[model samples]
Target: MIIGIDLGTTNSLVAVWRDGRAEMIPNALGHHLTPSVVGLDDNGDVLVGLAARERLITHPHLTAAVFKRYMGSDRVTRLGRRDFRPEELSALVLKSLKLDAERYLGEPVEEAVITVPAYFSDAQRKATKIAGQLAGLRVERLVNEPTAAALAYGLHQSEPESRFLVFDLGGGTFDISILELFEGVMEVRASAGDNFLGGEDFTEALIDGFIDAVGRPRGLSDKAATPALYQALRKQAEQAKRALSSNQEAEMQVLHDGQTLSWQINDAAFQRLTEPLLKRLREPIERALRDARLKAIDLDQIVLAGGATRKPLVRKLVAKLFGRMPAMNINPDEVVAMGAAVMAGLKSRDESLNEVVMTDVCPYTLGVEVSEQIAPNRFQAGFFLPIIERNSVVPISREQTVNTIQDRQQALHVRVFQGESRQVKDNIFLGELTIPVPPKPAGEISVTIRFTYDVNGLLEAEMTVEDTGEKHRLVIEENPGVLTPEEIEQRLRELARLKIHPREHLPNATLLARADRLYQQTLGEERQWISSETARFQAVLETQDEERISAARQALKQLLDEVEGESWL
Candidate 1:
């Protein structure tokens, strides 16, 4: 059976086609949304969703989430004994989701239709598909997140055409998509985003406020060693952050090292502290509106997604700026997953469901590294190559060719970039290619690069430097994930050979591997959190006594439920 998975940054959800409709599948936790966190024990076993997120506060050093923004980079974050690429880390989450769907359905589910941001680059999309492969699920299509949301919202109709501005504010990224829905084709007009902006900054602002009340916010250097005190402080700060949303003032009390201290803050005060962060959020919306050549009034409706959108301030700011109440028919939380299920139904061509054709946009610009002679500054640009125009219907392919400049050079260097910068250095360098060319004079040889973006936004690329059939005989295997075929095979074998256990221990063991280098400098309480939460989950495993994972999971849920921007952070 085909299902749609909204592999989100802060939280993830799954849904499937059944009984002539799409429905969300709950996890073991009895909730529709699961945190996109994974924790590891000392024995090298993994814990996904709730259990993993529990280790965040305590085992901050050993947990890493939201690596999605680094989708197409050379960044490598190390946790324990292993160094994982962003795609590999993402695979762990996807793999866990696959396991959950199978367990809930009591059947072996193999294929899926995943969703992505409409503005994702070819390399970023390729990386997502590769991650899916590593997770052991055959990704049938990679639909755009906004488009998927539209499908779930049913913007397609036989009536008058309408334009939509999809404002997606998820955990790690924020996107603004303008689409024109006409007939069955929902054409994307433009897309824009700020990868680093999301819900996390709000949390940080709250944390800073707590520190400010204590008179040392920038850093702890000014204080005389507040170790356990800081831990209790962070907890209270988090609580107060949540309280301020629903109340005029929030009071938090904590006892650490035999001292009881109280921190009090008002909602207006908290918003003021976070005003700078919130101000930046408007820039993306304005830019998106301008890019679509429309003012706020031109839009028929604005759709919202991502965990960050739940914040009251986010809602207020958007309403004030756009002068329109946002649509909330679908749960702001589960709409993406619902859309995924609907798309899967359409892709499968299930007879029970009606015809549902879809279309989406390219996430980023496809360009090459070029040398302009005006001072010999190297610039990456798409001024020439714009294959597969932005916001085109998916399952589409396009090609662009570049010429070699030097003779006797059998190899042509292909450097690809993703961004809107006029300078190549300003854009993201996905990777480079070295294509072998037949011996020829300078400017007489051309290399064609083919880029294909499918319905799910999965990317497949091909390059040929010869038209004479000499170098066109290379292999055409398309592996998009960060892990190569060999790496995926190796991981599968390792998992199969090991006696995987849910056995738990102290907090340290429960933190995910990539968190070590990330939050190492955290204080004792935070340091001990990983171990504490690990025990919380381990204790739940029937065979493991003195190991508990339940406490951590419950605590994580409690903490996250009250968490304003935890998912986006």
Candidate 2:
């Protein structure tokens, strides 16, 4: 069976095609959402989702979260006794989701469609595909997250001709996509975003405000500090930030290392703290609209997706900017996974979705670096010459020819880059290739560079020396996650050794861990009540009666739901 996965920065989810509809598959915890956290348990076994998230405060040295922002880089996160690359950490999350899917379908699932942010670079997309392979699944395709959300909304099933905008503010990344639907065809006109900006930053802003209100204590320098005050403050900031969505104010009191801090903040103060991040959101929206050559009023609908869109200020800003209320018919947090499932169905040629046709565009300009003479005796060596402009439809090729600058030039070097800058150094360096040219006088040797970007975001460059009729082909394959045959086998063996807790015990473990965390956060009678209920649930689990355990688990979750207000969900 094939399923769809949204490997988000803060949360991850899986879905599949079932009973003629897209259905989200719950994890072992009996919840559709899983916190994107990975850590090592006290017993040294791998812990993911809520279990790991709960331990993040007490075992801050061993847990890692928000690594999605480093997707294509070489950054390593240390989780207890092991250091792992971002993709490796991501693979663990994928493996957990895969296991959940297998358990839910009662089958060995092997293929999946994964979603990435629309503005993700070629390297980032490639890394995501490799993460899937490392988890022992064949990645059939990589779909853009915003486009996936659009599909989930059934924009193609609407009027024959319509224009819409998708403003996706996720946990660790933000994307703005402009799409047009015409005659059962959904075409993405443009895409833009800030990969480093999202809800996490907003939470950090609150942390900054709290620190400003109650001066930073000693021994707290970074997030990695163990037994420090920052983690507790971070958790409280997250809770208060969520509360401000409905409540006029949120109250917080935290004690660490004999230092007591208390504060009460309202919406106005929280807005002031997060105003910078809110401004960052507007840039990409304006850029996407400008690239699509449409005014805000031209859009027929504005659709919001990703968990961050639930914020009231975000919704209000979107409405005011677009002159229309954003559509919320679909749950923002689940829409991307739902759309990814639609893509999976489309991949398998599901009859119900056969009539729908979808297309995507390149998010950035791709070109070669060249030298241009700006003055009689001066030249700029890193000028960027665009072969294909940003937002161009995929599966397209463009060619440009250039002459040798010096006499008897023996070779031509073609350096590829992706960006919208006049200077090549400012852009992302993709790859390069050199072709031997027949010795010739200045301006006598001409070489043609052809850039072909496929629908899967694969870039192929061909350099044909005009005089010799010889060709040099380069398929830029420097993705950090791309593995060689030997590397793949080695990684497969390495991953095989990692163990996740058994499925039957995950729900109980997650609940107990959450209860333990609450016990740490509360005081007086509240703590006593939590302790009593946790002991009762522990006693029920000891009986090992499946039905009784399930009922108790539900009861505990409901009780916690009343106290926590479903903020985590």
Candidate 3:
């Protein structure tokens, strides 16, 4: 059976369409949301989700989270003895979700429809597909997150025609999509977003506020706190941020080097701290509306998706901007997964969704680098000529003709790029190919370059000589950030060999990791007490007595709760 997966930055979820409705599938932990965290246990077994998240503070060196922000980049995150690219880290999360789906469905699931940010670059989208492949699942489609949300929302709309906007702010990315539904057709008018802006940035802003209010530890740079302390501060800041969503004020306290640093932020203060990020959110929304050629008043509704949208500050900003409260009947966190499941059902030709049709737009301009003649003989290089404009409907094919720039030029070099920049150097180079042409005077030989962008957002470029009709296709396989087929196969084999920590031991392991982290964060007496309790729990675990282990586990948990409260977990 085909499943839909939301491989999100902060969390991931799996869902399946059942009985004509999308139903969320609970993970091994009996939770619909799984933290997008991966780490290694003491035995070198892989730990994912909650257990791994708990290990962030305890085993910062062995754990990786928020790797989604680096999806299309060559940056490597080292977890334990192994170094992993962002895609590999994401693949581990997808693998965990795949297992959860299989277990929940009681069948082997081989195919899936995954959701990605609409504004994700070409390489980022390719990385997402590769991640799905690495998880042993064939990716049938890569639906844009906001488009998926529109699909889910469109299904329930009573009106035959309506226009709405989807504002998605997740852990590490934000997207804005303006969509219109008419006569069972859901069309995405435009999509815009910041790949680096999201809730995590707000958490960072709060961290900065804390640092400014309460001085940092001695010998530490302004931005260079130790990982453990940073993790601790992050946890507290995240919880406090969430608290500030409802309450007027929230407090964050972290223990560092036997000293307790505390900061309290009221709603107004939190807003002041995150003013810049809030402003960043507006630009994308304005751009989306402008691209759609619609004013705010024309929108029938504004829908909020993604976990970060739960913030009162964000909601307030949306209301102030649109002069209306956004529609959020569905849970913001599960909406995209639900929409993905709907897409999966559509892919499977489910009878219930036969009448619904959805279409998306290319989020960025796809173009080729070129040189333009300035004088009779003078030419300036590094100009960008767009083949397909941003927000153009897909699956689309557009061509742009260009002449050779030099006399006796053996080949016309075509470099494909994606961005809004006017210069080639500022744009993201997707790939390049050299097309041979007969020797001729400058501007005499012309070539027609056709770019085809599919519904899944993959781009293909083909160049044809105007006179000879010779054609060459640009194969985007050499990008260093993307894994080659052979590399993918090798990585697959390696991932297959890595063991996942047993599900039954996760509670104990999580508790132990939490205790260890708390031990490291506490001072004098508290540290010694945590060490003792942790030892007792470890000894009980070693005994392999279920009754004793359960008793000791509960006792240790209660002790930790008394000392640190439940917010940290």
Candidate 4:
């Protein structure tokens, strides 16, 4: 059976279309939400999800989290004695989710539809697909997160014709999509977002505020804050952020160097701290509305998706901006997964979904870099010539004709890029290819370059020498972020050697890791108590008695919860 996966930045979830609806699959820990964290345990076993997240504080050197922000880049995160690319880390999470889906479905699931941010670039999308490949799953489709959300909502809407906007604010990325539904078709009119802006940024804002307010006064330099202390502060900030969403005030406290640092923030203060991030959210919305050629009053509804949208502050901003309360009938955290499941069903040709048609747009302008003549015998390089404008409907092919700039030019070098900038250097270089032409004077030789963007958002460029009818295709294999077939195979072999921690031990390992992290964060009596309890639990595990071990696990978990408060979920 084909499953749907929401390969998110902070958390990931797997779902499937069963019983005529999308059903979320629980992991080994019996939870639908899995933190997107990866780490290597002391025993050299790979760990993912809660266990890995808990290690961020106690075993910071062996763990990695929030690596999704570096997707499509050359950034490498070092965990334990090895280094990993963002896609490799992501593949580990995908593998865990794939196992969960298989266990839940009672079958071997080999294919999936994964959801990504609407504004993710070509390299990002390619990297996502590569991640899926590494996980032993064929990525059937890479659906846009907002488009998937729209599909989930569109399936239930009774109205045959309506225009709505999807405001998606996840942990590490934000996206805005304007969609119109008519006659069983859901067409994304426009898509825009700040990939770096999300709920995590707000939490980071709180972190900075806490540091400025408390750490600075204590003569704590940025370098003076150790990884464990930073993790503790981040955890506290996350908790405070959630608390402020419902409560008028929240307090963040962290223990560092035998001292307790604390900061209190009210709703008003939290807003002030996150104002810059809030400001970044406006431009994307305005751009989407402008591209769709509609105003706030024209939309029938404003649908909110992604876990970050649950924030009261963000909701207030969206409501004030739109002059209407947004829709939250569905759970924000699960909406994208549900929609991804819907897309999977559609892909499999589920009878109930056969009538629905969904369409998406190219989020950015795609064009070829060109040199324009500025004067006699003088030409300026690095000008961008657009082939397909931003927000144009995708699965499209657009072409542009250009003449050779220099006399006796034998070949035209085409550098493809994606962005709104008029200068090529400012845009994202996708790939380049050289098309040979007969030597001739400037403007005597011309070539037509055509770019075809598929439903999966992959691009194919073909350049044809008009006079000779010679055509050459540009394969985007040179991007540093993308892995070639050979590289993927080699990495697959390498991943095969890394063993995952046994599923049966995950719950116990997760609890122990959490206790360890708490041990590092607490001070005085609390720290001593955690240490004793952790040892007691470890001793109990050595007994090998199922009943006694289970009881001890529960008791220790209760104590940890009491000491650490409720979990972020």
Clashes of each: 36, 0, 0, 0
Candidate 2 wrongly placed segments (more than 4 Å): 217-228, 480-486, 522-567
Better of 3 and 4 by TM-score: 4
Where in model 4 is the C-alpha error above 4 Å?
223-225
lDDT at residue 553 of model 4 (Cα atoms): 90
lDDT of candidate 1 at residue 204, scale 0 to 100 = 59
lDDT of 3 by residue, 1-569 (tens): 99999999899999999899999999876789999999999899999988899888878889999999999788998887788889888998998888888888899999999999999988899899999999898996999999988777754355888889999999899999998888778888999999999888999998888887785444333644577777877888899988897899999987665566777789999999999999999999899989999999999999999999999989999999999999989999999999999999999999998888888999999999988888988999999999999999999999999998788998888888999999999999898888889999988999999999999889888889988988888756656598889989998988888998887787788788888777777778998999988998999989999999989989998999998787331
Ranking by TM-score: 4, 3, 2, 1
lDDT of 2: 0.86
lDDT of 3 at 128: 91
Candidate 4: residue 312 Cα off by (Å): 0.5
- Higher-TM-score candidate of 1 and 4: 4
Best by TM-score: 4
Lowest summed lDDT window (length 10), candidate 2: 219-228
Over 20-84, each residue of candidate 2 has an lDDT whose tens digit, in order, gives: 78999999877899999998877778888988888777777878889899887778887766778
TM-score of each: 0.78, 0.93, 0.96, 0.98
lDDT of 1: 0.66
Tell me how far the alpha carbon of residue 451 in candidate 2 is from the true structure, in angstroms, after superposition: 1.4
